[model samples]
Each structure stands twice: as structure tokens, then as C-alpha cells.
Target: MKTIKNENIFFLGVDIGSTTFKAVLLTPKGKVHHTVYTRTKPMPDAILSCSGECHKCGRCNLGAISKTIDDFLASAGIDRENVACTITTGSQIVDGLVDFIKYDAYVSEISAHVAGARHYYPDVKCILDVGGQDSKAILFDEDMQMWMSKMSGICAAGTGAFLDSVAAKLNVPVEDMDEKVNYDSKLQVSSICAVLSATSVNKFKNRYPLGDIIGAACRAQARTVMSGVGELFLDYKGPIVFQGGVASNNAVGYYLKEITNNEIIIPEFHQVMGALGAACLAAELYEKKKKKDASYEEKSVFKVGVDELQQIIESVGGTPLAKKLGGLKNKLFVHKSDNGLEKIGIPSIKQVKDAIGDVHLIREFTDIFDKVVLRKPATDKGYFKKSIAMRANITRRELFSRNRDVPMVWRNLFYPPEILNAFGARTVTLETYAAFRARNPKKLQQCFDRAASKGYSAETCSFLRVLEGDEKLPTPDFAVTTTEPCQQGERIFADLVRDYNLENKYYTLHTPYKLSEHSVEQLAGGLRESVKEMEKAFGYKLEHDKLAEACEFSNQAREYAMQANEIRFTSPPLIHGSDAILNALVFSPGWGKPEFVELQKTFRDELIERKKEVELYTNIEDTHRLVWLHLPPFYSKKLMNFIEVTNNAPIVYEEVNHVGWDILDVNDPYVSLAKRILTVGFLDPELRVKKIAASAAH
Candidate 1:
């Protein structure tokens, strides 16, 4: 440690890296006085609370980082007034810091790292640094002249964050890396891409021990670093200083030694070296200013023009990436049938809707569906696994490309899907379609914005907000709605009818709460009128023969549903919760349709066959079976997989599965149809609860 000419003059440096923030205090001689290092987000409670207020004033960035610095200073009992100058360095340095504390000196992170490392190891010829999200290497020749520098590109492989992510997946703490990794283990991971490496890690996790897997990950990270740096390491260099957060990992150090064949020196505060470097640079700047007696304006180069970019981002109320993605309008071409229900190529309107998230982070449902589900063989057991592929094909051929000579009906869950099926009409559930579009949280927010802009109440269900804003759905020739599933459905239906000017073609059923004979007839009359309305609207007569035939198909589907439930309740369940819910997604929306009935038969027969084979397996264990009430989340299929696969708690039954499956009376069609809707238990709140409880009891 060296003393400066001015003892009162102190230099403060802040390094705000992608994953963590570091603050350090140094005398004019660059001797460290205090230091702090921690993650950037999930900030310390005090800073987070201050950020809340700053966020209200559009100064959150300053409030958060400055508060963190303020707390760090307080911990060291240092006053800001004693600091003669302060400097900041990082990839995300912004002008907002000037407004926070009037500290405007900004140094590039690369310069800071070099200066910081040179302070401890003056003879060091090269620096290897791996931060949270990126990696870099700098080399110099014998004359101390900078020769080369290389950095990992946008891919975050070979970085501290990448290692942390893999550690989380393996259920191992990142700090335990030194003890967990077996250097002698021969396991290897070849992918240099962070996303791809994660997939590899997950694949090998079950096959390899934690120690060997982490060792492989470490080797892969080392290989990735060497690959990024290219042949620059081969140049003669010794005393290579390893800085940045990843320097803390001993396994990474071991692999680096093996690759570089050079002694790697890790400084005492390796994780906060960037901040120390910034402080050293600040010390130099302070000394120069004192000797020259010149006043250097405290300002950042980026601060001059950041206001324009800030305004642009604020105008859109999101990151630039979100705005750019939101502006994109990609069209998907499809072949259409006359009925308008039949179409090819456009499976769901969401497939064409612009993805809503960070450009790099967007995960399209279509990609996952095609690669994971659609690519699965048709013979795969379980309804969701096999039937989803089956249903997707059927939906494209029958619903999208089917004959549409009859009038089409757009309805909600409360309305029985069978009546529309019997009338030879195409039916689409508005809620289900909205659910699909709302899978991504950002997209859902966009939908909510659209409805809110039109003065729709935010208190309304999210699905309804999406339905009100989504205009891509085909215009139905007639709308059939029931009055029992709370007032929300009726309100949404009325709004849609009014918006589309379909007042003359709308039918409503005021279904009864009780299942008595009189209530049944009252409900039955309302349904019968809906059938007559369809006839008048389409200029076609109601055929009693077709109605009876469809009822028989409904009975067969119901029979299969009962058998499927029994199979699920077996000791070691052959069916997953998602499969059961998926069956309802297909059947509840398309009950009485021939394709749905056949799919049900396929599911039932496959389960019966699987049961026999599963019984032969001695290792199978019965998992906790939870009954999910109401509809399954339509946003992401991965969530279901997490619950079923990761948590191993499979839902055996969903309330929606009971729709139109309670043994309809084929002889008295209208009365039976009315009874099904009332008994499905979605009509009333208390009844739905009781139905769920009863199912759980069984």
C-alpha cells in the first residue's frame, strides 16, 4: 500500500455488471479502504424500497444503484463528501447516475480490468476474465504493448451465469462447485452455446453423478473460453491473472490451468476486481488533476445523448426489443374451405401473431409443439402425447378445412358443444382461443392493453380481455351463449354480438341451477329454441335422426371417459394429468363430433393396453394424484410437464372432463342436453366446488 500526497482525497469506483454490482473505495494511492459485492437484481431490501419510489419518478436506475452504493459506504463508515472523485464502469453505465449523486466520471470496463490487474501483478502479460454474461481475454507482449484482445459474442456460454444456471438445474449450489466436481472424471459436454449446454446438462443429469456432471460442465466452459480466445493464448505469456466473478470457481481454475499451461494468479478480491480497477483509474485521474491544477467536468460520454433513447423506450412503455417485435406483422397463408371453419396451415391465430418478449428469449409455442408433440409417433401412449398430434391433424382437416355449408356458432364453455355438432355447425370456444394467445405473459399484457384501451374493466378475467381485443377470430354466423356461468360470459357474449353486429343471429339459454323435472324442462325449452334458431339462420331444417345419431356418439365418448378415469385411479397411474385435461380440451370443445369420439376410443383402448403392460413393471410407483378444478392453464404446456415430470404430482382428473359425459338421454334430446350443461357443474360457483370435492372423494 502506498500513500498519496493528499490524504483527504478518496476515489470511489462502481462496477455494475450484468449479474452483480461491485463498489470499492480507494485512497489516491489506489490502496483499498472498503469494498462490497452482490447481485444486481433482487437488490438489498433497503435499495429495493428506495427504487420503488424512484420508479414512480422514472429514476429507478439511479435510485437502485446509488442506494446500493450508499449502503455500501454506510457499512464502511465513509462519507460521500470525503471522496474527491468517483467513476463508474460496466456494460450498462448510464447518465442517470449523474442525476442521482452528481458522480459523472465513467471508464470503460476493459480499461478498468486491465488497470486493476496490473496494480497487483505488474509483470502479468495477459488477463482472462469471465463475468456473469460474457467473457474476455487480453494479452500483451514482453514490451507491455497490447497485442490482442478477444471476447465471447452474445452467447453467454463459458460465463459465470452459465455455470450458475447449470448448477441450479443439477440441484447443486454454485459455491459447492469445488467439492462437487471430479477433475479426473472423463465426462464431457460439447455444446458451447448456453441454451444448448443446458439441454445437454438436463439430458445427462439422470445418467451421471452430480460430481462428474459438474466436472464435464467445467471442462465445457473452459473449452468454450479457449475457443472464443482462439490461438492468442499460445503466444508466450506468464503470470496470467484471472479476474471477474467466475475466478471464484476452483474447477474453472483447474480447467483453465490444464488448457493454458500457465500459472493463473487469482487476486484476493477477484470477484470485485473490476470495481478495484475502476478505483485505481480514478486514483490516477485524481492525481493528474491535482498536478495539473485543472478542472475536469464530471460527465459521461453516454450521458449527452441518452435522453433520446430513454424517450423512445418510454414512449412504447417497454424495452426497444419488445417494441420492435410488437411492430412485426408476419402473415401465415392458409387454404380455406367454403364453411370458413376448414383451413390448412393456420392451426391457431397465435401462430401468426408476433411473439411478445425479449427478441432472444421468445419461445414460440409452435416450435415446441411441432418439435416435441407433433414429432412424437402417433402410437405413443397417453392421450395428450398421442391425441394432441391426432387432434392437431384432425383440427386442420375437419375444423379448419371441413365443409362449412351450415351456419357456424362461436360460443363459450357453458353452451353444450353437442347441439352445434348435431346441427352440422362449426363451433369455436372464444375462451379457449384466448387462453392459447395468453400463454406468454407479455402477449397477455398486450391483449389486456387492447381491452383496457377500449374502456373494458381490468377486473374482468384475463381471457375475456384477450377475447375482446383479438379480432382475428372468424366471424360466426350465429352466437349461442348460456346465462349460468356467472354474468361474465353473458357480458362478453353481448359485447361481441354488438361489436360484430350479430344481434339478429344471437341465441341465449337461461339454464336452471337445479336439476329438477320442471327446471330441466325450462332449460330444455331454451336449448330446443337454439336448435330452431340455427335452422332459421342457416335455412336448413332440424333433422331428428342426425340428433339421435350424434347422441349415441356422445354416449360412447362418455363411456370412454369413465373408463379413462378408472385407469387414472389405478395404483400406478398410466395417464398423466395433462393427458386427462388435454382430452377435455378436445372433447369439451368438440363433443359429439366424430373425430373427438374416435380420439376418445383411441385414448381408452391405449390405456387398457398400457395398464396390462404397466402392471408387469415392478418399479412403477403411485404418485400423489391431485384433482385440478376448472380448466387447465392454456398458456404453456411446459408448465404441465414441470408439474407431472419434475414434481411427479400428476392430476388424475379435471372438472371440465365431465362435460356432456353424464349419460345423455338420446330419446329426449333437448332435455338431456339441458341436463348435461346443468350437471357439468360450471354453471354455479358453489356447485363447481362441490363437484370438485366429490371427484376428490372418489
Candidate 2:
């Protein structure tokens, strides 16, 4: 029997690109530790805290960086005993032996920008990176490695500082500049640089509005940037990534979209790419350092911000990136690939390949190729296989059988995305689906190409044929389909809101079915008992049978429990099998006529009580104001009591549009008595005595 001993390991990548420095820490199996960022400022503390990782190997920094790392480690409560390795990048890396070592290894920031963008937008062949000081345009083939590269090596015109300078002079806060430009829809500022543009704006200020001037500036900046991108490639192959710090501006994003006639993807952390790249690089290096120490650990994903990491650093006194270098010396050995042999130590290529196994390090440092370690003896890379729900977008509650049974027929006719938002579900079109699908490797290159050129759809995204094989994307929690009915027996219509306890959290949605109407009606009997207290407020005595019925539904609405086609009764005239029961419970104050509105109000007030709800109607404030405008004449708080019936006018009644009213003469003999009687306001005015029939019938 042969005995084999293995060490635990990790890897890191430290990317010091043009604008920023980034550090990434990952296990040998590719689990990321943390990603940190700091601007290009020469703060020694920031540098060391960022790159001087731990005590895997010890060496002198550029003095300032060393101290910064030492102080930061002290502050982090970490002793220099745990880290196994460290890597450095950025312009400052030109210091000493460490400088010479990584200079050749140092990658351009553009690579990470391209790589990460490729991570999100794989179809990006023609790409432009517009940043703070300069902008770079790169044209690449399908794989996204640089095929051609161009730069605005000398210009402050289309940069962030340029925007900041103009915005400050315009009396706008730097952050507010983007919002202001977005709102200004008409201004045309200068594109020719700060001095010339300022002159143009100042010269035209007397005749042009400030907004128009700003709008002009916005357009000019967009034009200048597009011109730079045009210098790279004219026929714009996408997904066009608008990366770098300036990409954070929505105005810039929108403007680029209009100019290129191409969609722009401003990723969530576009401003922090340099740092993310640096972090990713650092993580790759750390994994190499760790390979010297421990043999194995399953890869894991974790979430943390900078602050949480501070606590980790503080826990170990700062040193090298290892278990413990001397005092915090880590006992792991992996050969160096190329970057870190001199400053601390490097493992030869043979030791690295033997220990950490196979990892493909593409020269640019963005694309990482890792060999899958098989626990179950399978060579399958799970990356390409994921289950995604593809018809459309579904609500969280729509997973139920009841709601699923309710036809999506209405969804096709008038699917207000607002309804999905209201239901805590999202509604996305095929375009988003296409973009999301691009992340799937099974999708062909031509599919993305055509979608980018002609726009994506089921007609486009799914055009390649083969509806035959079972190809899955990420498994979706729920799927929303369009035009097709749900699978039989799987159709759900249960309103999760009514089925769940948190009704207020879902106040915006119609009640979901959680209970049966019959079960709810049983509780209505008990609800009738509470009606005694509600009768006066409602201006009517309760009918026990009807009141009991309302209670049953209300109770069921409170408790979301039901099956497919089950009456959740979560909402009225909706969310259930029927509304006839509640509709019957509410009666109009008028005889031979029905006041649907009053019945709705009465039923709701009795059920929900005086508990103040947020925005009582969908239209909210506008609807409330309209209600006040249509207030009854009998309820007039402004009418003078002593005024006699001199001018009867038209004797208008709102009911005229519905059941309607008859006209009364301007000088009727009994006008005074009739008008005064009308003032008290009967519960159901339309059902009132025949003497005062609808006076203004339509």
C-alpha cells in the first residue's frame, strides 16, 4: 500500500490596471474569499492592506506599502501568521525586485474589463472602454481577446473629470450632473474639449436655457465617445459593453444607446472592475500559496463586503499570505508559475502541476480554466447545465395550482408588468430572456449574432431547430408561460397572499387563494356577531346570513390555504372561484336598483375594519381626489342652511347616468322641503320614496 500526503491550497490574482488596483482571493478549487478596491491614489495603507496579503513569504515593500499593510493588519486584528502568499500590481509595482518579477506578469486593465464583460456579454466582438482619463476601443473576434486596440491617449474632453469640471461650473453637484443631463433632453454642449466647450456654452447662455445648454453638453460628450468607438469598428458588433467608471452614469449609458443604435450593458460593479480584476488575480495567487499547505477542500461561495473582511484581517496579526511565515508560517509547497519567485518564494512549475492539479492560466489573467475534480467519478462540467423557466415571468404566488388554472388569457391581452411587480413577481420580455440565455453555453454563436443584429425573440432566440432534446439552463424556482396552458394537474391558482400570514406585505396584490369559499363561509357565521358594532358605521343593520357569509370569506382571505381552482377568496370579484356570494351580501340603499360602489365599500370596511391601508386604490391619490370631487350634493358641508329654495337649477343626481333622476322645476312649490330632505342623505338614495324619483334621467 502506498501512502500519500497532500496539502490544502488556494490561489490569488492581483490586477493593477490603468485606473485602479484589484485583489481577489480564491481557494484552489475556485471559491472566492474577498474582492477589494482602492482608487489609483498612492495611499501606502491602501496598497499594503490590498496587496501585502499575509506571512506566506516575507519581503520588504516600497517602505510606505509595507507599513500600510502592517498597520492595516494590526487594525484588522490579524497577526501576520495565516496568509500563504501575496501578489502586487499597478504602476507602483515598479519599485524593486518585486517590481521586475511581476512587470512581465502584470496584465493590462483592459483584459479584465474585456474578460468580465465577456463573462456577462459573451457576444461582444466590438467593444469600447471609456474611463476617467482616457478611453480605449478594442475590436475582438468571438472569443473576446484583443484583436485590435486603440486609445484616446491624450484627452480630458470625454472623461469623468471633464464632466465634473463642467458640472461644478454649471452650479450642479458632481453627482447630480447625470440626473440633470437626463432631465435636460434638449441641450447641446461642446464636444471639442473643456476650454472650447466652456466658451461655446458661455457665448450661447444669453439665448439658450440652462437645460438646453446642458443637454447639448450631454450630446457632445456622447458624440465624442462614439467617434472614438467608431475609430475601432463602424458596423458595431455587440454586446457593446460600456465599461469603466464613467459607465456608472445613466445619461452616458442612454446616450451611447441612442448613438450606436446598440444596447449598452453597464454592469452592477462597472466602476470597480480594476479592483475586482486585481482581487481575482490575487485569489489565484493565494490558491497557489495554499497548495503548499493543505491538500483538499471543496470549493465554496461566500458573500461579504469590505467591513466584514476587516474583522478577519484583525483576527490574525498581519504578515504574509499563509498560515504562519516564521511566527505565522504556513507549511505548504507549490511551484511558482512565473510571477512570485523572488520577492518571497516561488514553487517550480512541476510542484504546482503535481500538487494543485491542472489550472489553465491564460496570459491576460482574466480567463481562468480549472480542471474539475471528480468526487463521483464524472468528468461533467456542471457549468453548462442549468434549469431556467422560459415561457415568460411568473409571480411567487403563481406556483399554486389555483392561480395557474385561472387562464393567462388576460395576461396576453393586457399584461401590466405592474401586476407582476405588485405580486412580487417580475415580468420580463424575450429580450431579457435572450440576454440571459446568452449566459448559457448551449446557445449557438449565430443565435447571439442575429439577436444582436435583428433583435431577439422566441422567433429569434429559439430559431436553430431542435425542440427535441432536453437542454436545461439554471433551474428556475417558478416559470411563467405565455400562450400555452400549464401542464395538466399541475395548474395552480392559489393566491399565495391569501394563503400566507403576511397580508400587509402583499397588500398591493389581490388576495391569493389560500382557503376554500365553503370553509370561509363557515366562519362568516361567527363574523356576523361582530356586525352589531359595525352596523351604525355602515348605516345599516346586519343581515346575519349575509354577514356570516362575508366573514367566512374574510377569514379564508386571512388564512391562505387552498388547492387548484380553490376559492382563496383573497380578493373580491377576483382571487377566487366566485364573487356572487359577497355581491349578494351587499344591497343598495335604493330599491329596484343596486349601488355596486357602496356595496364594495360596505363589505370592505366591515371586513378590514378601520386599519389604515396604504393607498386604498390602485390609482391612489388621483382616485381619492376624484371621489371627493364627485361627493353627493346632500353631503355638502359648504351649503348655507338658511338659503331658501330659489333656484333649483337642474336638480342633478349622479344616479342619472346609471338609474337616473327626473328634472325638478327651478321654482317648485315643495322645493324647500325636498332639498332639505335630500340633505340628510338616505343609505340608498335610489331606493328612497317615489316622491323624489331620479330628477335627471339620462
> All candidates' TM-scores?
0.45, 0.35
Backbone Cα, N, C clashes tallied per candidate: 7, 131
Please report how far candidate 2 places residue 607 from its true position, in Å.
95
Model 1 whole-model lDDT (C-alpha atoms): 0.70
Q: Which numbered prediction scores highest in lDDT against the true structure?
A: 1
lDDT of 1 by residue, 226-253 (tens): 7877366776557678888888888888
Give candidate 1 misplaced runs (Cα > 4 Å). Answer: 1-385, 397-399, 402-404, 439-446, 585-587, 618-621, 637-642, 659-661, 684-690
Alpha-carbon deviation at 421 in model 2, angstroms:
87
| lDDT over C-alpha atoms for residue 513 of model 2 | 22
Residue 321 in model 2: lDDT:
19
